[model samples]
Target chain A: MSHPSPRRTRDPARKQAAILAAARAVFAERGYENATIREIARRAGVTHGLVVLHFSTKEQLFVAATTPDPESLFKGVLDDDVTKLPERIAASFVHRMEASDGADPVIALIRSAAGDQQAAKALLQTLQQTAVDGYARVLDIPDLATRVNMMGAHLIGVAFSRYVLADGPVAAMSPDELIARLTTTIRTILFD
Target chain B: MSHPSPRRTRDPARKQAAILAAARAVFAERGYENATIREIARRAGVTHGLVVLHFSTKEQLFVAATTPDPESLFKGVLDDDVTKLPERIAASFVHRMEASDGADPVIALIRSAAGDQQAAKALLQTLQQTAVDGYARVLDIPDLATRVNMMGAHLIGVAFSRYVLADGPVAAMSPDELIARLTTTIRTILFD
Candidate 1:
């Protein structure tokens, strides 16, 4: 086989990050339906073969791009005691949004996955497996399953509508205002 | 040209709705990126020329498909006083989800619209404009623009995540449960 390209062979870590970043941009711009491995490779300044060799598939690349880094969206909270449930849960949700830097590319990914079943199976499960569990640990309700799910739905729906749809004044509000209002709602539901 | 299609020449209302339904399905399935008038016509069981005769263009057909007819999402609310705010707002959101019956095609439309300027502008603005005006009128807040926009973002975000993503248990909850939990949260911010 031909030797790996010299530029790529020199810096594997940088190449990996470049591929991930490129995947995010292309996925955001084109949505999963239209985004292609070739486009991502082109955006990353890498060859088609490199993408396949690195990520192995477009689905895998997208999963890597969006599957929220569990540590990033919910790291410290998991270790905290149960009594701090409401604040921790609220902080976790807020952290995810803040970590995203308001770009909310994950929203684009979830929306794309909505149109594609396999993609949906991957992207839509993050909350069920991650967020719900995090909240469950804190709430410790016997019916934790239902309550966490409800609150999760509300938070997810509200965030998507306000930020992604840019519906009315929500999209225009300062992030601080949003945090205040949403944190109140979230705190009430989780703590009360 | 050949004789006009019977639906076009004799039954404008039937033909118009048929085209709109077809457009909605096409936008929902193929999304804006790949949707074409030709495909919409084929789905509608009409000739391409017939689609043009009614909608003039796919963009027009798309707007016509999502455009609120009786008013916008908020028309009914604006007609009444502020007391009906909670139920009306909840109903507005629930109605859209119920009408779509959980298979939200609008998600695909919003996702595909990220790159299409005209489609994005029309769809996003319609979502924001009507709800802002309606929701703002009901609440006590004097600065409607900032508060409404922020709340709108939360609404769309939560709805998309819940309804479109079908985020497992979250989406499975009954409308009554959702309204119970979310309505209180909404009231806290809007009424208080």
Candidate 2:
């Protein structure tokens, strides 16, 4: 005489989200090498077998953890050409990155991909396409691909070194300083 | 002839150099994650036990491996005033890096220390001392400690993302482009 259980149907979605969250956390803490399927399952409060049953392996889980926001990352930057090209591109990159000050989950995914060639290629291709396509569509310039790529490198590289690596001088900079200085530098690179 | 055989003592130095070279190559190719003592020994054309006898452990070997020209790293950069700081720092840093590009053999040693917290600390401390001691002696700057640390983070983070992680756009830029853009961007941060 029991009512139908709400937990049974909703459990899958909840479990999936939990698993993904666990994957990101574990990957960040352990990087790619030390992260294990059992640890992820434990973090998610699921059984080890359940993780295997769902994703098959650590690599699969790593890939899945990154699946949700692919299109959004592209769309966020691409469609945000609300200002003209150089300013929008430079500002948006720093702004969005600065937004992730306390919560840069994408960094772990990106950094871990470096250890695996195939994963790196996938991430790299998507990044290049989104940046190149967005810049080309939004602006009229010579060497669109090269200039965009170079400017993009300095922006992200500077940020990564300063914020993520907490590399000294850069980490000391306030976010406003970061955005202003970075934008000014990259603005010239992109336009002038 | 009863020879004064300096060659008698020379072989050990030769062996040490060979081991260092092998360790560097192995560390760079596999990074900290995949590198192993066995593989390094194989590369050195020495037995595993020989490596142990010489180095005691991988950790000791790593410390020994980080010996580069620390004195030269900031020598040229701090020679001038604040206005010239950015480009000077960039040139000297990149010059040191570029000069050692192929001849630099301690990469595996550095990579090995990346994740292990104690090891990361040791490596970081060495670099920090190098930057501060050198920069403070040469430059007319205040807040040398903070600047040294931040610069370390910036350089390390940038190097990891650009070279080791090969993060898309960061990976694509040439050395000249990297130095140029990084130099300009680091200007505001490096100066008042």
What are the per-candidate TM-scores when only chain A is compared?
0.76, 0.71
Residue-level lDDT of model 2, residues B85-186, one tens digit each, is 777777766666666653342233234432553443455556677767877765556766765564554565455545555555556667777778667656
| Residue pairs in candidate 2 whose N, alpha carbon or C atoms collide under 3 angstroms | A167-B150, A167-B153, A167-B154, A168-B149, A168-B150, A168-B151, A168-B153, A169-B150, A169-B151, B27-B108
Per-model fnat list: 0.45, 0.16
Once fitted onto the true fold, the runs of candidate 2 whose alpha carbons sit more than 4 angstroms away are: A1-10, A47-57, A67-103, A109-114, A124-192, B1-10, B72-85, B91-114
Q: How many clashes in each structure?
A: 24, 10
- Where model 1 places Cα greater than 4 Å from the true spot, the runs are A1-14, A75-105, A143-168, B1-9, B71-84, B101-114, B135-140, B145-151
Interface root mean square deviation per prediction: 3.5, 4.6
CAPRI quality band, candidate 1: acceptable
* TM of chain B, each: 0.75, 0.77
Clashes of 1: 24
Instruction: Give candidate 2's whole-model lDDT.
Output: 0.59
Tens-place lDDT per residue, model 1, B147-185, is 554455545555555655556665677877766666665
